[model samples]
Target chain A: MPSLLILMPLAGIMILNFAFGRTMKRSAFWFAVVLFLIQIILAIFHHPVFWSNELEMVDRFFNVSFSMDYISFIALLSIGIVSLVSLLVARCSIDNEEDRFNFINLLVIASIGMSGIVMVKDVFSLYVFLEITAAASFILIAFWRKRRALEGAFKYILLSAIATIMMLTAIALLIVLAGDPSFSVIKSALGRSSSSFMVTLAVGIFICGLFIKGGLVPFHGWLPDAYSSAPAPVAILLAGIVTKVVGIYTIMRVMISLFGFSASMGRVFMFIGALSILVGAFAALGQRDFKRMLAYSSISQIGYILLGFGTGTTIGILGAVFHFFNHAIFKSLLFVNSAAVEDSVGTTDMDKMGGLASRMPITGATSVIALLSACGIPPLAGFWSKLIIILALWKSGHVAYTLIAVFASVLTLAYLLSMQRRTFFGKLADGLEDIKEAHTRIRVASIILAAITVLVGVFFPLMFDNFILPVKDILLR
Target chain B: MNELYWRIFLNFSFFIIMLFIAGFYCILVTRNLIRVMIGLELLIKAVTLFLVVACYVSGQAALGQALIITLIVMEVVMIAVLAGVVLSIYRHNNSLDARRLRELKG
Candidate 1:
């Protein structure tokens, strides 16, 4: 029942995309909303699947299987919520008629692909879904067809192609060494195999591929351009869910499910996560553009989550999950606020605006909330998640990493405050007194997200105990 | 004790490696987008050859090889379409150097 609640909307959206009709656009948006509401009901009520074991369906030569646990279930809910918010944001931001349809349809397909990635048990199945998501994202990025949009889309395609090839080659090597593509088979093979060289090579290649997709440090060249140039609604989905599911989630699955979370692998993840944290934070401090600074800050926040998960301890895993949820909410809120700023004032350059709070009150207040949330202020979601991660790092006795994590959080706040001060405070900018606030739908979505950010912070214990703790146990085991 | 088989395997691996390296070099150094596309095609071909060799070494059936060959054909068609698109871009901008095409940045 729960799976259907998630999968049916995906199927409906795919059909709606190609069906030529006058009412397709409105129908698709409402259909997507219906899907999200159903997912919400399922999440709140907690329906249990009848079958205790894994469910597999054999279609032609492919085996598509799904196994549900707390992590995937939470992931499904997050994707649903974010997709709905993005839809609402899009409905407000997009002006053209044709673009509205394409944007919403691509979003539906991308959400389906993301959900499929979380649900699928097979590596090849995951690859197929990832391809769907990546392809949809490529089209969406180039949806604008402006010169910058085209270049960003092209670079995204090229880099994604490179990463996919690396991953495929690594999968081929694993098949050669393990003789099977199943996660369980590969995991056991890596454990029992005497050829350390082959195992190391395979792991190295796979990690490289994952990191490129994950946008960690040096492999993050394509991220800022893609995030900054794409439409803000699409950017919300991309920055919020796409990177988390395809990149970070894959790393977690590979490490915990396929590689047994080895100490050496943990060390490697920690190093990369630390590098991403410092590099992303320091890079963000220098950005003058609102969206680009947010993009860099996201990279830094993702680093925190990755660092927590890399510790290979239960506390660490819990921190990582918390950080993931926090980052998603605040980042999407920030992106939407950026969209609102762009809509009202017609610019994303922070230097051009001295003050906007007087002109766009709702946008101003919500942007402030999101900025504080992102900066990890106490009583906001980001703060608790950041605290949990630092505690986890300290508990794991990684003193150096813990310090770096705290430093990165401070840096995140500093840049976010700078952006806020430039855009929301002081006198109104020249020729901007008449700029209006965002449309109704946009304000509603941002307000809901800001409220969630605060609610999640206050209810951290419930979040950790119910959702994150179970997932941590599963990953650490 | 099969010296002939050893000689054949080593010669095959050497040829495959050379093909792959040449294709990779072209992809890395080529300035023209069309030449780079050709290089990518060559690289795929070389990888297919290597995959076929691995299958032979592992005593697998011809299914993997057959699948790869079909993929190569599909890749060729896709590349042809992409080449047309790239050609249009080049004609519109009057250049083929990828480095010069930086109208997009943060």
Candidate 2:
């Protein structure tokens, strides 16, 4: 019964690919909506008693089990929401029947992989699921079969392959040391055993692999291209949740639960996080393409999330996880807005667009809301998370980083507002007289996301109490 | 007796690591897409061998073998898909040169 959460998506993929491939041409979108809704309902209501019972009988029957901690619960919920939103976005953007079929199939499979990653108890299974997700993403990014798409996918595959090799080596070393690959066994083993050169080396390699996956500054070569060239819905999914789940969340879980955070590790995370923030924000300022700027902005926002985790405080981790949820909402909304703009205007180039708000009011309004939320304006969700992170940093005596983070938030606002001014607020550019609002389906998705951002911001205390605090308690326990 | 066995295991592990490094070098230096794929395959083989050796040394050969089979299956699927993608790239550009596929820039 517990396994159904993962299996249902796999089943969806098989059914969509073969069983209904011929009959379900236009109805595929609705079919996927129902499928995702079922999965989300199951995830929310299907918490097994044995997960919290601590019974050996349960362990014997399921040697490999899903964790039912707050971390996994929140991750699962967010994955469900993002996958549903991405599916909706895809409904409007993807027109070709064959392409749509493949997209839904791959997205379902990728969702399974993501669900497995967060829920699984063992490191080996995590690696397997990570690979599954990576493989699916490569195809999704290159689905258009365009030259640029292929190039993006190829770069992603190459970089991801190298990261996989590193991770595999790390896993092999870890298995030898622990005599098993499960998280509990490895944690206990490391606790009993003293840190040695080999252990340190393995941990370093593992973290490096995750950093590349997460698109931290030095290993982020493929990120901009992959995010920019991917179909807009795919970009929304990638920027919104894929990197967060596969990259950032894994790093947090391993570093906190397995290695146990040390001061040196904290310093390393902060330095890297600061570098990514500055570099990503500054580079975003120079982008001509709209999606590319958002891609860079994603890297910058991710830096904030990492920096919060680096503080290793309860409030810090809370802020980080909350920001993770917030980033998923706003970033995906922004990407969808970019898609709406591109679809209506036929290009993502910022210089070629102007004064579109008068025409595409829904897209323009939602984009403004998403951008403001992203830039940490007060009365919005991003502001509260950023405030918490800064407070955590200041409390932890990282005065310099706090200032830098604050400064980078300004940089974020500068680029985003400038982007808004160029694309929507200025005088209408020539040849855009016929531009219309994005498809109703696309508009609905953006509206749903924008509403969540506003509602979460307005009701942040309730959100923090009900959602973020549980995750923080688990992490800092 | 156990010390001698341990020494042999350590020596073999070192050799495998060296082979892995060599494969990594091949990937870094090669410009041809096919050669890079070959390099990737070599790396997978080296990792597979290492997993087997680790399992043998730890007396968990059965579990290790099961894992290795799964790993090999995944590796084969990955390489096959990668090869198809590379072929598509070649067909489109009329060259397998990695340098020529540089349309995206920032």
Candidate 3:
């Protein structure tokens, strides 16, 4: 039954691609919707017999297994919701019939890989799933097959290839040391031995690979280009969840659970997190393209999550996990809003847009809501998570990082508000007079995401008690 | 005899590292897309050699062989897709130079 989450999508892809083909391209969209609904339902009712400490067999024949902890559950839930939203947004935004069909199929496949990443207990299986997601994303990023899109895809693959090689090296080293690739075995082995130079080298290489995937400073060359060129729905998926699962989640899992968090590791994470925050915010300040700015903003927001986990405290981990969920909602909303604006006005450049609020009221309102939430405005989901992160940093005695995080939120507000002013508040641009609200589908998706942000914000205590506290407990254990 | 084997293993590992560095240098310096891909292939080869060596040293040849097979399959798929992208780029731009494919910039 647990395996169905992955197999169902593979079946959907086969039926859509080979069985239906181009003759029934429209059916692909409906097929994807059905598959997503089924997956979501399965996720909601997914009750594994084993809990955090025990591994349950996902595929007995292959000896593959997964564990269900609170962290994996949150990851599973977010991947389901975010993928569904992105699929809906894609259906509305993409006009090419063939492209739409292929896009939906690839997305479903990628979601399977993502869920696998969250659930898998062994490093080798994790690598396989991560590559699956990476392969799907490479094609999705270049779905349009334009020159720039291809260029972005090529650059992404090149960088990712290097990261993969580094990761493989690390895996080899770990396997050689522990004589097995399972996380539990590796943990016990490492715990018994003093930190050797070879182990340190392997860990360093592994973290470096993850840093590239997560788009941290000094390894973020592929991010802006890929995000800007990808269709808005793909952009939303990549920024909102893909990077988090492949990069951030793995980092947190390995550092905290497998390796055991150390003070020196925490300090390294704090420094990198702080650096990404400053760099991403400052770079975003100069961007004219709305999606590109949002892309940089994603980097800055991701920095906060990293900073939270970097503190290595229970509260910090809770804040990081909560912020991870919150960032997915608000960032997906913002990207969907960007898709709408681009679809209606035919440009993502903020300079090419103005006073769209009067014409596209829903988009304007949703974009404002998303931006506010992203900026950590009071009474929004972003604020509570950022507050928790800041509090965690301060309590952890990283006063300098806490100060920078607070200042970065102010910078986030400055840039996002300026973006709002340029795109929606001032006089209507001359050429965009006939612009109208986005299609009903796009509007609906954005509204759903925006509603989540607001609802989560308004019910913060309920969210903390019911959802976050359990995940915090698991991380700290 | 064991000491002699150790010396040989160290020399081989050092040689693989040199190959890895050379491939990395090729990727960084080359403007041609094909050359960059060649560099990537070189790095993969080096890594594969290193993996086999590690497995041989650790007496886990069977497990290492299985991993290498999987790695090779994945590597093939990646290279195939990358080649397709390169073909498209060449068709669109009429050149294989990375410098020419610059429509997207900050």
Candidate 4:
């Protein structure tokens, strides 16, 4: 039944299209919502039926040998939560039920790909799932078929195809050296031939592809364009989980599982992290488009997760994992608020928005919660994760980097607060006096996400023990 | 068997590098979106040949074939989607020049 996590979604997609009518069309939204909820609950409870492999009869039939661990749990839970939030935004912002139905179907497909990504145990299988996710995302990003979306989609296609080629080329090289594609097999094989020129070349190319996929500073050309031009819900999904799963999560898994993190790799990771932080923060400061600014902020925050991970300690890894999840939740919350603003005000230009807090109280309040957490304000989830990362850096004697990371937070706070000031705090804009609140589903989505942020922040110790502590087992691998 | 891999790799290395360079040149120097797609196709073609030769020499023809087949299918899907986007862009702007795609600047 472990494969059911992936198989069931595929089956759902097939069955969803078989008897297409008004009921199936309308039920698509609720069906995906319930499926994501079930995914979240199973991940939370760590259900023995799926994780324990008791159903050998069914498992043998599939021959996939999917496994779940604490790291996968974190990834899977974030996938479910972000997909659910994306669906909520889609339902509210997309007035056409037909479009909603199509959007939900693609969303389910993307989640299946992400689930496969988290569960698979081989390099080749990992590539397959990554393509599945990317293909689904390309279609989703260009769903509106407008000029900006199309332009963004084309650039993404060229860049993503190049990344795929790079990764596949590396895999081919590894296959020639290592006889099998499994993580354990390749790790042992590559470990024996660690210092050869070909091996280093292969590893470097693969990581460069991942840097592009992750939208780090050097390879981030297509990211902001894709995020800002994609329809609102797609922005949430892309910024929240798609790029993260396709890029950052893959880097973490491949480095830890296949190529163990050595000091050299740690140095590379930290260098890239510092560059992305400086570039993303400064670029975000100049953005006037609401979604584009958030997209740049996404890059900056991703840099923090990389910095945490580069520390190469248990506390650092734990902090990275926690920050990954928090980024997904709060960033999606911010995007959902932007969707609400778009639905109500019909635009996302910050310069054109003023005093929206009075018009859309729920979105405004939730956005405040999300932004404070993003800025690492005290008693917020982001603060604790940042604290862990900075402490790890200091402990590891990277005091210069620690100072740089801390100062970057002030930059993060300044741009985000300026965005808030321009969009929500001033006197009402000319044409927005009659604006009403967003759709009810949107309000509820933001409230739930905000509540999670507050609760996770307030109960930091509880979350640390129950959800994040087990991530240390990954390092032991 | 390892000698066979090295022999085959040495024979094909120059050709693959040429293809790689040509593909990059095409992609970098092109102004037309269609030419960009063609360049990407060339790049994928180069990789596919490399994968095929690598699998042939590694004695893991089964895994190599499976990967290339999947790679081909994924490429077709990607090219189709990208072409559709290009078509839509043409419909909107009546030109396929890369310069026309400047609507998303800072």
Candidate 5:
């Protein structure tokens, strides 16, 4: 059953807690590792025996109807991969056994929530799962109970609450017009009411909610704080998949399925996407903290995804989804590098360290690969996706937007390379000598992510038919 | 839209807007962490009311009520977590001022 994708992890958590409390705590990492691996395997292979079956009993009890497509497949794959990487980071970084146990539970809960997000067809179920993910993230952000983390969590809480309210209001409006919560019902309702002012107002409110969730410009004030102050593993989870799934993916799905991608909507998306790119790039240029800089870089990357998807063309959406996957992997790899640096050098302030590449060879090297991919350098996964987006924009006759995308890419290269040189390429900054590479698990995470990035880029031709073609079917739907 | 439903919306919207103004104003002005949480609660309260009225207007009270129940449950969990976070912030700084929470700035 498709619902098993969500239920399986939930079952793991329940078993972890009541099955054998303290004893299970020690084995929690392995349990989570196995669980995520299964999800990864299922998503990649698309096992028909598991996917084709359905449990009428469970479906009726939950009253949810889920349908899977290429979009959900891509989202599920990323969720599993990012969660697995985050798990490894947590295994090494969090020392306290109880704390680690709690973190594991939250990670699994988040996994279940995200899985629910990708699979659900009803908007109310979508809202429920979004809150589940958000709640788990709030606790995860405040896991350390440090001052910065708590503050960050508070800001996220307040903003997330506001975003929820906006979305609920929109949902209510849609239900009033459509009299149902299912995508098909609401979509038909929206189509019939397309000329109504209230239709425009509802769409506006809903998109605004998504923008806040996605951390787009004007609604991104809470994002950098939540991201930079979060613990390393939590940072990876939040940055890699959580916000993307909630904000950007929802925008894609809802616009395609419900609002039908109006021209005005497309224009609004392009304008805001461009704004986020310029603003996030300019802001990152001044940040000194390594994690903070990565956080801003993340905003800029999100702009690329948005800009591509905004084109509202099949090729453009294909590019956006591919870029989403690429961003998740490379960004996670970069965060893993930051975690490694923080573990050894005891700071994220980029100004403090230099020439450390000699010491942390694996992290330094993998980070180079990641940064290069992020800059859309040749033969990397980022290049192909970016090329597709630019091509789509050009074909659509949006020459100005196409140029803006290219210029911002140059900006991406500039900020990232400069930060990299300051942190890894200069003379060792007065730190005498004693430092070591990150833990084994961390290096393992770095290697795995870097491998995916390089392999996807290298095997682009073979994988595109397997991956990108499926995404085009979403537009067809 | 039905005429009765449109009239109901026109009447209910005034109270909803008032509640939203009150909630947002409180959130923007309040420095105390607890009050901030309270402001969040106010916003949610307004949303809940709004959802109910919308359901009534559409004559789909069943789905709307079910959603409200779920939302209430979710809201409680959220508030409880916020309270815990607020308590931690208080312990760290011995105060709940939002200004003290600005250490993460650029």
Candidate 6:
């Protein structure tokens, strides 16, 4: 089954982990990587790709369906690639063996839940999968079992629980009023004549919950803590795929498929996206910890994607997907690279160390590439994506938003460049001569993602046409 | 008049609301990590109840009930495992107030 292709990695991990609880770190890590590789192969090679029927179970109150299509394929590919790289990067912290094993299993579980949520057509099924992903993330954040780790997990759990409940209650109301959850059925029920009050009430609650999950501005209290505390590999998965998949991807899918781009809704999304961009970028500028800064940067980056989608043009949606793909690669690269830096320097405090390029060339070079890609620098992945989004804004005739986006992109570059300077250049601080390069697997992971970032930038059209265009068409339709 | 159905709906709604309030109170007031988790379990149970009752009222019992029960089982299993994890945290950290373990601050 197509579902199995996404789920098999989690199953494989469960077997290997539970049966061979004492397996060597290298074996466990390789086993997970190999499993993901097999998944990637199956995802690419499977012919006549069997999309499962929309399995539906209808009751008076709930109509549920599990459906997969081209959109699900996009999510699957992202999950497979990002998670494999994250796992390889996690192996450098050899001291936390048990935590590493647990983190790998949780990553697999979250990936399965994410892919499942994207594929499922029913709102209720989406809620269930969302919870699964959240729970897995909570456990993974607390994997380190430090004071901060538990605290971060607790905060994340509490906030996510509230958001999930809001989503569930909204679904309940939608089902009670509309009688079904299938995309086609719901849209028909919401036909051109539905009362504005009911529509507003329902849509507002749903969007608020989704915004919280996406870590947009006011609801982003848990993000910096969770991202900074989570193990580097797990952080990569969360930043790269988890937040985007369950939150932004689902919101975009549901709004386009069910709600249509009502003028009021579009304006609200645009405003929220803009606010998130400004707030997230400014907030990130002050962070001292590398991971924490990256966390805030993710929130800002997601704002651009949201802004692109909110523009409601075909070009706009395509640009959003392009940005999403680009962000996933570079952000994951940055997180893993931070792990490498931490592994070598014994700390993530950017100001405490310097001259890392001379010490750890791989981490320094790869990180610079990632940093450049993140800041929309030329000939890198971020630039094309940012250009597309800005062009989309201009074409949409939202000149003000276009200007704001350009401004945000520049601020993004400034802060990121400063971060790079503080961490990599200048004189080495006291007691730093003994530091070495990251573990073999960690370096391999960084180089792979770094290379992909450059390749995707150079061959933008190929990736855009083959990978992003189909998903964009599906969502836009 | 469909009085019986209306009464069932009101009863279930009251029960779900009460469970939610209790869970909120526990999350807000409790100091123990285990208790906090119990509060979460209670909240999830309330959600499940709400879903199932909503399905029944709307006359769609089969799918919702199945999904709710599946959710209940998942919560139970996951909560039990997490309870063990919390206990370990308490052992190592020497407190479960969840407020004291502030080691990873920025």
Give each model's whole-structure lDDT.
Answer: 0.77, 0.85, 0.85, 0.89, 0.89, 0.78
Give residue A257's lDDT in candidate 6 (0 to 100). 73
- Please, what are the lDDT tens digits per residue for candidate 6 over residues A1-477? 555554566557667766744755447777777867876665554344445532233221243335555556666667788989887776666457776777777777787788778777678777778888888888877776766666677777767777877777677667655667667777777775356676777778888989989898778888888899887777888898888887788888788776677767777888888888999899888989999999999999999988998898878877887888788899999898888888778788988988888888998899999988988888898889889999999998999999999999888888888888888888877788888888998999989999989998998888777776776656545
lDDT of 1 at A308: 89
For each candidate, report what fraction of the true interface contacts it reproduces. Answer: 0.13, 0.43, 0.52, 0.79, 0.90, 0.21
lDDT of 3 by residue, A1-477 (tens): 455567667766776667645666777777777776766565555555423333235466546566667777677777877898898888878878777877887898789899888877788778889888999999889887888889989989999999988988898778767777788898888887664987889888999999998888889889989999998889989988998889888898888667778888888888889999999999999999999999899899988999999998999999999999999889888888888898988889898889999999998999899989988887999999999999999998888898999999999999999999998898999989999899898889989888989998999999788678887667646
- TM-scores for every candidate against the unseen true structure: 0.91, 0.96, 0.95, 0.98, 0.98, 0.89
Pairs that clash in candidate 5: none
Residue A394, candidate 3: Cα error in Å is 0.9
Off by over 4 Å in 1: A1-10, A17-20, A43-46, A50-63, B1-20, B43-94, B104-106
The whole-model C-alpha lDDT of candidate 3 against the native structure comes to 0.85
**Model 1: which residue pairs collide?**
none
TM-score of model number 2: 0.96
Q: What total of clashing residue pairs does each candidate reach?
A: 0, 0, 0, 0, 0, 3
Worst 10 residues of 2 chain A by lDDT: A50-59
lDDT accuracy of residue A445 in candidate 4? 90
The DockQ value obtained for model 1 is 0.30
Q: Kindly list the per-residue Cα lDDT of model 5 for residues A1-477, writing each as its tens digit.
A: 898777777877888888776888799899999989989898898876777777889978876567787888888999999999999999989999998999999999998999988887878888999999999999999998988989899999888989999998888888887889898888887877754878888889999999999999889998999999999999999999999999998998889887788778989998898888888998999999888888888988899899989888888889899999999999999999999999889988898889889888899899999999998997888888889889989989999999989998999899989888988887877863788889999999999999999899999987778977888867876
Report the C-alpha lDDT of model 2 over A276-365, residue by residue, as the tens digit: 999999999999999999999999999999999999888888888888989998999999999899889999999999999999999999
Q: Which residue pairs in candidate 3 have backbone atoms (N, alpha carbon, C) closer than 3 angstroms, thus clashing? A: none
- Candidate 2: CAPRI quality band: medium
Better of 3 and 6 by lDDT: 3
Candidate 6 deviant stretches above 4 angstroms: A17-28, A42-47, A50-66, A95-100, A192-196, B1-42, B77-89, B96-106
Model 2 pairs in collision: none
Off by over 4 Å in 3: A20-26, A41-58, B1-9
